[model samples]
Target: MNIIISNASSDPIYTQIMNQIRQSILSGELQAGDSLPSIRQLAKDLQVSVITTKRAYEELEKEQLIDSVVGKGCFVSGANKDFIREQRMKRLEEKLLEVIQDSKELSMSQQDVIEHLTILFEEDQTS
Candidate 1:
């Protein structure tokens, strides 16, 4: 449970916490059944309000990324392969949307964007 909060970020503090935790789970850095710190402990460690940490945990639980156990603590939930694939696809769509917006701002044609993406993909494959 490593979390960094940035007051300067446009995202809310709770959102930042939630996103980082979600990313850790999605990336397999936090394995299934891994114990997470108690909400109070995490709040103390991050120096954020307990309410903020609670909200983040609630959201994660709602998303089925973690489960809360009475008197124990929050723990990472087992991953569902289908759900994970869907989440990854959603993330990819978000990133592509950002790229599309950037390309529009730069007056780049669709073909130009596709060419750049293709080149990047080739470079990545080669690397």
Candidate 2:
């Protein structure tokens, strides 16, 4: 597993850590039962505090994305496909809402936004 931290981000260090790990699990880059680095090791690797890593792991555990075993460190949890799909859809919806707000602030019409989205969709398909 690889994690990158940015001092320029608005998010806290722990939140950045959590978001990266969450994305990895949701994208299947981290599979069920895959081991994660120990908290101390990850802290050393990231040059962050162990408390920050622990907080990220704890939050993931609350979301049932990972599980901790005594003396065994942490591992990704098996997920229901439906639940995972719902999670991804919700994230997309949140991003779409942000785009909609931005478009409205710029006085862009609905049709204009739709056209832009269509072009982006086609561009993605072609790529």
| TM-scores of all predicted structures | 0.70, 0.69
Predicted structure 1, TM vs. truth: 0.70
- Cα RMSD to native, each candidate? 4.8, 4.0
Per-candidate count of clashing residue pairs (backbone under 3 Å): 0, 0
- Residue 63 of model 2, lDDT score: 75
Q: How close is candidate 2 to the true structure, as a TM-score?
A: 0.69
User: Per-residue CA lDDT of candidate 1, range 36-76, in tens?
Assistant: 99999999999999999999999999888999999999999
The residue-by-residue lDDT of candidate 2 on 50-70, one tens digit each, is: 999999999988778899999
lDDT of each: 0.93, 0.92
Model 1: per-residue Cα lDDT at residue 14: 95
